[model samples]
Target: MSKKKTAMPKITLIVLLSISAVLLILLGIWLVGELKDSFSDPADGTEPGAISTSVSGGDEVVMLVNSYIADMRKDKTLTIEADGVSVKLDLNEAGAPVDYDELESYMKSKGYDTALIGQYKTVLEAQGEPGSVYNDEYITKKIDELAVNVDTGSDTEYELIEGGVTFYRGSERTVFDKAALADSVKAALDAHRYDTITVSTTKEAPEIPDLDELYTMIYCEPADAYYDVDENKNTIVVDHVVGYDIDIELIRKELTEGTWTEKTFMKQEILPEVTAETLPQKYFKDLLGQQITYYNTAEKNRTVNVGLATAAVNENIILPGQTFSFNRVVGERTAQKGYLPATVFQNGGMQEGLGGGICQVTSTIYAAALKAELDQVSRYVHAYKVSYIDLGMDATVYWGSLDYVFRNNTEEPIKIVSSAKNGTLTISIYGKETRPANRTIKFRSVVLETYMQEMKFEEDLTLAPGAEKKIRSGMPGYKVELYKQIYVDGVLQNEVKINTSKYSAYNGLTKVGPKPVVTDPPVTEPPVTEPPVTTPPETDSPVASGTTGEDVPVVETTSAPDPNSPGI
Candidate 1:
C-alpha cells in the first residue's frame, strides 16, 4: 500500500508538468503572432520581413529624404566658369541638384530600408517632385546665358559705293563645350557637393560672308538709254547704268592673306550700246513725214479738243518694233481733263458728245504715219464721210473700244511733233530715214457709185398757210475707192487700191403748210331751159376734140414730180 500511494503522487506531478509545457508552447506562438502584427504594414497586411525600417508611410519616407536633401544643399554654391565667363547657380532653389538614386543611397546610409526608399520615390513622383533641373534643356539655357558675356565681334559687313563694293573685317570669338560643363555639374551634384567647374573652350576665327553670293548681289548687265514719259506728261531720257565685274580669285587671295584694304577689290566698267548723250541725236535726226489739216476756227469746243489731243501726242517717242496706240496715249476725255462737248456722228445723225473732235487728231496722225511708211496694226474709218478728212482716210477712236494703232517699222526710234495754230493743225514724224529721197506717195479717192437723197414732206401746224419750211438738208451717199500712188522722181511706180468705203444716204425732212380751203361756186339753175335739143358736133378733117363748136374750154393735167430729185 505504501508503494501504490507514492506512484500516484508522482503521476500527478508529471501530468501537471505536461499541462504547463503545452500552455507555454501555445503562449509562445501567440506572442510571436503579436510581434509580427506589430511590425507588419496594416494597410497592405505585409509580413514583418517586408516592413520598412522606422519610416512607415510614403509621406514619412519622403519627409526624411527631402530633409536630407535640404540639409545637403544649405548655403552651397555651384558655378560654371570658363575663360572670361562665369555663371553661378543657387543650390537652395527648387530643383535641388541631387538625383533620386543618389538620394536613395544617402537614405540607405541613414538606416532607411530599401523599401522605404522606394516609397519615398513613389511619394515624390505623386507630388511631382524631382523636376527636370539638370536636363538637356537646362544645360543649353545656362550655357547660352553664359555665352552672352563672351563677345565675338560683329560678322563681316559689305557696302556698295559708287563703282565697287567694300567689306569690313570681324574679330575672333571663344565658345564653351556645353556637354562637358553639364556633365561636370551633374557629377558634382550627384556627389552631394558643390564646387566651381571650369568648362573647356575653343577659339574660332570670324566667319567671312560667302564671296559668290556677294558677287551675285553686286553684278548686273549693262542697259541702254531709253525715253519714257514723266509724271507731268513730259518725255524724258532715262540714263543708262554702267555694269561692273570683279575677279573672285584675287579677292579670295587678299582676304586669306589678311592683306585686304578698302580698295583691294577692283572692277571693270562695261559700256552700253546706246549712251544717253547721243541717243536723241541719233534717233530723231531727219523728218520722215508730215501732214496738215484745217479746222473751223469758229468752232471753239472742237478747236480746243483738237489742241488738247495734239498736246497729248506731241513729243512722244515710239521705239523700233513698238506700236503706238492713240486712245491709250490720249486717255478718256472728261470735263475734269478740260474737254468740252462738241458735234459727233451717232447712228446716222449728228449729236453733241465729249471728245468730239479727237478723231480729227487720230486721222491726222494716221495720215502722217502712212506717209512715214509705218505699218498699220489697227485702223477704222468713220461711220460716215467726215469733212475734215477725205473718205477712206479718216480714223475714228472711242474710249475703251476703238483705237488707232501703228508700229515703227524702222530700225531707229521715231518721235511725233504736233501743233494747232489758228485753223491749221500739223503733225510731223521724225525718225532715221531709210527710204529714198526721191520717193513720194499720195492717196486719191474715186467715186464708184452715187445714191440720190430722198425728200419726205410732213404737214406742219406751226408754218403759215401755203408756206413750206426745210428741216435737215439731205446728204448724197457715195461708194469710193481709195488708191495709193507711189511716185519715184515724178514717175509712177505702182498704183494700188487701198480700201473701198460706202457712205449711207440720209432722207431730207421738210414741213409744209396745210392746203387752203376752197368753196365751189354755187350751181345756178340754167334758166330751166333743158328743152333745147343739142346736136353732137362733128368737125371736118377729123379734129381731135371732145367738145364741139365755140371751142369748149380745155383742161390740162400734169403728173407729180419725183421726190428723189436733187431740187425736191
Candidate 2:
C-alpha cells in the first residue's frame, strides 16, 4: 500500500508539470496578440501624455470617420460674384457629421435605397448627393447672371426707348430682354458698399414770354347819345357804340398776371407820379376828340372842339411813381385834324381863322384834372379868361406847341375816361380812390388887380379919289390885365395870371375932297391947255365928319404889329 501511494504522487506531479507548461505557452501566445493590437506601431516619440481609455480595438473605426469628415471639409468651396464684384469662400467641414439613421431616411426620401455595410458602416447608403450638393460656385454664377446695367439720365442724356437686352459672359450668352435694368440695378446697389459718382451733361430750359409782346389800351365807353332832359320826354336813350369791340378780356388777363408790368419802360406811357414838367395852357390835348360848348357872357356863344383830353389822375391809375405828360400822349394836331375857321384871341385882340375853339377843349380838361386833384405839373390860363370851366382852372392850347402833363404817384393801374358831347365835355378818372368818397374840391379865381391900359379903336373910314368920307371913324381902345387863382378843398393852392387882351391904337387918316368937277368940265371944252384952270380948290373942303365921304381909320393889328418892335 505504501509503494502504491508513493507512485501515485509521482504520477500526479508529472501530469501537473506537463499541464502547467502547456498553459504557460497558451498565455504567451495571447499576450503577443494583445501587444500587437495595442502597439501595432509604437506611438511617435514626440507624442507625450497621450491618454487612451475607452477605444482599444475599435480605434480604427473612429480614425476612419474623422478622415472622411476632413476630406469633405477640404473639398468644400464657394464663389460669389455679381455686377463687377467677385468673392471666393473655402469652408472647413462644409458637411456635418452623418446621422446614420436620419441620413438613411433622408437618402430613402430622396428616392435612393440605402443599406448598412460590414461593421455597421453606412457607405453613402442612399447616395443623396452627399445629402445636399452645396455648389457655392453654382449659386454665385446664378446671382451673377441676375446682374444688370443701370442708367440715370443726366442733363444731356438722350431719351431712352428700349428694346430687348442681351448679356454675354465669354461664350455663355443670355438675354433678359427689356427686364428693366434700372430696377435690376436698384436691387443690386447696396449703399453700404458704394460711393456716388456723377456724369456731366448740358441742357437748356424753355423760354418764357416777355413784356414787349404785350401791348394794351384803356378807355371807358359810355352809353352813346344824350340825356333827353325835357322833363316830359326825359328818356335815357342808351346809344350803341359803333364798332364796339373792346379787348376787355386781354386787358384783365394782363393786369392779374402782372404781365402789364413788363412794359413799365415804354417811352410814351404815363406814370402817374408827381414830378417836374411844364404844362401848356392847352395841354389837355385828348379833349380834341369831343364836341364842346362854351358860355362866355362877354363873348357870343360858340361851339369848339377839344385839343386834348384825359381822365382825372388818381381816379385812373397812371401807374404810381411814373412820369406822365400831355404832349407825350396826345401827339400833335395839324390842319389834318380838322379845325374850323373862326375867331381866336390873339395878342389881346381877336384874330380871324387860325386855330379857334381849341381853348374850349383845353379849359374843360383843366377843370377835370383839377377836380381829380392830380399833381399839377403844368397849367396855363386864358388871355381874357373865359368861364367854361371856372377861373384858375383853365388850359389853353396852341396846337403843336403847348401841352399838359400829370403823373400817378400811386401804386396801381389807372384808367382815363374822357368824353365830349354837343355842348358838354367830361373827363373821368377810373381807379382806386385814395380819399374818402365824400371829399370835396373847390376852385377860386381871386383877381389880384386888373391892369388897365389905354388903346385906340378905329371906326369906319373910307376914301374916294379926292373926297374923304368918315363914318364912325376913330375911337379909343383899352386893355385889361387879370390874375387867376386855384383852390382845392376850400384851400388856395396856387395863384396865376390870366393875361388880358392887348389893344392897338387907331390911326387917323387925312382926306381932301377935290374941286375936280369944274376943272374937268373946262378942259374938255377948251383943248385942255390952260393950266388946268385951278378952280374948285375949296369945292368940297375935307368933307366934314359924316357925309357921302367914308373915312377909313387904320388900326395896327395887335398880333402883327411890328417886326422890329418889342412886345409890351
Candidate 3:
C-alpha cells in the first residue's frame, strides 16, 4: 500500500520478464528436435533431417526393393534339357509350385507399400526373361529314347499244350536304364536349382508278367473222390495233369543280360496232388458233417441266388491248414453273376438289396464247419434273428467287409459238397473222420435273454371302417449262446461254448381305424296281435230229431236251373 506511487513501472518490468522466459523455452525445444532428427537412423523407420555423407537416400533404397520384388514376380518357365533337346514347359499349367500370395505377403513384410507393389508387378510383366521351375518331363523323354524292343517269343506254330488251351505269345519290349532314368530326372530338376544332375544310357528290361492268370488258365482241376451211397460204389476217378507254367522271376533273371533272345520252351508239368491212390481212407471217404438250410419257396430270386452260391462252393477243396474265405470262393455277388434283388437286413432294418440270399448258403456252411470241428477264423452274427437257422449259429456275409472264414484243422484235406434243391440248401464236409464211430457232434443254442416286442398302433385310412389290422407281427429278440455238444456211445462227453449273439428287438406294427366309429340306432320290433274273433249267425235250436238228435238244415234239391231252362 505504501508503494502505490510506482505501480506502472513494476507492471512493465514483469511483462518484459515473462516474454523473455517464453522465448528461451521455445528455443530450447527447437534445438532438441533438430538434434534428434539429425541422429535418427532410417533403418529404424526414423526419417533423417539431413542426408548422410555416404550411402543412398531413402528413395533409392525403395527403388532397389521394388526391383527385387519385380524380379521375383516374373512369369516362370520350366525347361527340361535332355537328349540334346530342351523341353520348354509353361509354368502356368496345373501342378505348378508357385505361390503369388505368399511372395506378396513376404514383400509387404519388408515394408513394400501398395504403390511400390503395383509398380513392381507392372515391371515384372514387362520383362521378357522366364524364371525357372524345373520338373519331371526330362525323365520321360530320356526313358523313351533309351527304350529297346525285345523279342522273347518262339516261331513255333500255336499249339494247344497238353491242357487243351492256347494263348498267343508275343515279343516283349523293355527299358534298361529305368532306375538311372528316374535318378537322372530327379538330379536334372535339382541341378536347375543348383543341384548335381546324373544321367545314364544303360537299359534294363521290364518286369516279368503276372503268372496268376496263366496258372489259372493252365490248371486242370482234379475231380474229388466221392462215395456214392446209392450205387454202393466208391467212385475212384483217375486224376489228370495240370500242365505247364513259366517261372516269371527266372525269366526276368535270364533276360537281365539285355539280349533279346527267343524264350526257351521252359515248361513244367503239374500232376494231380490228390488221386484215388493218394486219397486218405478216412478223408473224403466218410461224411464228417452235414447241414441243411430251408428257405421260403416263394422267394424265387433268392432261391436262384442260393443255388448259384451253392454251385460256386460245390466240390471246393480245402487243403490241410488252409483257410477258406467265403468271399474269395464265391466271388462278387451281382446281377451279372446271377444274384437277384431280395430283402436283406441292413442299417438296423430289413431292406431289399443285392446278394440277399447268399447268407443262407453261408449259414449252412458255417453249421457244417462247426460240426467238422474246423477252426473259426472270423465270423459275425446278424443284427436281427434269422429264421433259416438257429440263433447264434447263423452266419451273415457281405463282400469286401464281412466274411466267413474257417480253417481245416484236421490233418487230412477236406472237401465241401454243396447242393440247393426245392428251397433246401445242404452243405456237407467230407474229410478223414478220425472220431469214434459212435461219437456224434451237435450244435445247440441256449437262450440267455428274451425281449418281448411291444405293439405299436398307427392310424391307417386304407382299411375298412372300425377295422384293426396287424401290418407286422413282432419277432421276439434273443440273447443266445451256441454250444458244441459231443456225445460218445449215447452219453454226453463234453460241451464247448462257441459264441454269444445279441439280437435287437423289432417292434410290432398295427393299423387302426382312421376315424371315430359310427353306430346305428336300436331296432324296434312290432308287438304281436291276434286276429279278431267272429261269431256265427244265431240259429234256433232245432227240435230234437227223432233218430240222430242233431239239428241239420234241410237243403232243397240244390241243382241250379240251367240257363236254358225257363225261370218260373
Candidate 4:
C-alpha cells in the first residue's frame, strides 16, 4: 500500500509539471502575437502578426503621408478676383510656400515624429500653418494663371484672294498688371483672408495693322514661266504667277470716312511677261543637226573621257540668248573625275594627258552646232592640228583658262543629245526647224600655206654605234582658211570665208647612237683622187601628203613607227 501511494503521488507531480510547461509555451506565443499586432498596420489588411517596420512598409508609410498632404491641399481652392475678371485655381497646382523637407522639419519641430509621419499628416492638416505660409513662387504662379484668364482681344481674321483682300476687326482687349496682382494675392494670404481679392486692370483698344506694311507684304512682281527638271528627270514647265498691288491711301481714306463694310479692297493684277503658253514652242521636238564620229575603242581611257563629257552635255537645254560652255559643262578633268592619261596633242607633239581624246567630242559638237546655225560666242583652236577633224574645224577646250562657248541664237530653246557607243560618238542638236528646207550649207577648208616638218636628232649611249631609232613621225603644219558656202536647190548661192587657222609644225624626233669610230684601212694602195663627179641638184621628196594640197618634208631614213603616235 505504501509503494502504490508513493508512485501515484510522483506521477501526479510529473503530469502537473508537463501541463505547466505546455501552458507557458502557449502564453509566450500569444504574447509574441500581441506585440506583433502592436507594430503592424491594420489599415494595410495584413495578417495581425505581420510586422510593419520592414523597408517596403516604411516606404509605404512615407508615401501615405505625402499623399495625405497632397489630398488635403488638392481640395482647397483660391480665387483671384480682378476688375471684371475672376479665376479659380486648385491650391495644389500652385507652387508650395515651402518644400517637403522644410515642411517635414517644421512638423518635427512641433513635437511630431516625422518617422511616424503618416499619423501626424491629419494633425498638420488641422493646424495648416506650415503648409499655408506666404510663398512668392505659389503667388506668382497663381497670378500667371489669373493673367491667362484675363479678357484679351479676340483674334483678327483676314483673307487674301486672287484680286482682293478682306479684314475683320476683333473686340478691344484688357490687361492687368501681373506684379500688382501678385502683390494683392500675397497681401491677402499674409492677412489670412480667404475672400475674393479685387484688383484693378487697364483697358486697351485693339491695335490696327499698318496698311503700308500690309501692302508691302501683299505686293509682288509677276514671275515669268520657266522650265525645270522633275524628280523623275522629266522636263516640266512651271506656270507664271500674276502679281497683286493695293493702294494704302485709298484704304486710309475709307477708314477715315467710315465707309468700310468688310474692310475689303480691290487689288491690281499684273500679268507675267512670259506666260506658260508663250514659252518656247516645240522644245526638243525637231532634230536641228547631228554629227557622228568614230573612235578607237581600244583607247579605253580616251573612250571613257569621251563618254563622261558626252553624258555631261546630253539632254542639256540652252534657252535663246543663253550660252553653252564646254568647260563649264564638262568640268575640270582630273583623276578624281576618272579621267585617265591618254595621248593628247600638246606643244605641237603627242603626249600623255588627262582627258586626252575628248577634243574629238568637242570638235564633233562644234560641227553639230555650226550645222544647227548657233552663234559661236567663243572658240579656240588647237596648237597643232588634231587627227580626227579637218585643220580648221576642231575646237579645243581647257578648264578654267579656255572654253568653247556658243549661244542659242534662234528664238526657240535648243537641246543637246549626245551618246558614245560601239566605237562611235554622236551628238545631235534639237530645236524648232526655222530654216528653209531648200537651203543647204557646207563647210570648206582651204590650205593657204604649208610648213614642212624638220628632223631632230638626239644622241643615245644605249644603242650601238651609228644605230638610230625613230621616236616620233613628223607632222606638217598649215595655214588654212575655213569657208561657209550656202546653196539653194543644189545651186551655189554664196560662199563666205569663216576664219583662218595656223597649225604649228611638229619636228620628227630620232634617238641616234654615237657615230662609228673611223680607222685607216691599213693605207693599202694610196687612195687616188678623181675629179669630183657633178651630182644633179637634190630635189625635196614628199614623205607625207595632205588631201588639202599641203606639202610635207621628206625623211632621210625610216625606222619602226612609234605605237603611241596620234593617227587618224
Q: In lDDT terms, which candidate is top?
A: 1
What TM-score would candidate 4 get against the native?
A: 0.47
For model 2, the superposed segments whose C-alpha errors exceed 4 Å read: 1-317, 337-355, 399-401, 409-412, 436-439, 452-455, 458-568
Clashing pairs in 3: 175-204, 176-203, 176-204, 177-203, 177-204, 282-432, 283-432
Arranged by TM-score, best first: 1, 4, 3, 2
lDDT of 4 by residue, 268-331 (tens): 8899888888765536788888888878787788888888888988978887777888887778
CA lDDT of each candidate? 0.74, 0.39, 0.63, 0.72
Location of the lowest summed lDDT over 10 successive residues in candidate 1: 559-568
- TM-score, structure 2 vs. true: 0.33
lDDT at position 530, candidate 3: 62
Error of 3 at 361 (Å): 0.8
Predicted candidate 2 versus true structure: per-residue lDDT over 395-479, tens digit per residue: 6666566666665554443445565544445555544556544444444455444443333333233433344333213223334
By lDDT, highest first, what's the ranking?
1, 4, 3, 2
What does the lDDT read for residue 522 in candidate 1? 48
- Per-candidate RMSD, Å: 14.3, 30.1, 26.8, 19.5
Q: Measured by TM-score, how close is model 3 to the native structure?
A: 0.44
Cand. 1 Cα-lDDT: 0.74
What TM-score quantifies how close candidate 1 is to the native fold? Answer: 0.52
By the lDDT metric, which is better: model 1 or model 4?
1
TM-score of each: 0.52, 0.33, 0.44, 0.47
- Evaluated at residue 83, the lDDT of candidate 3 is 39
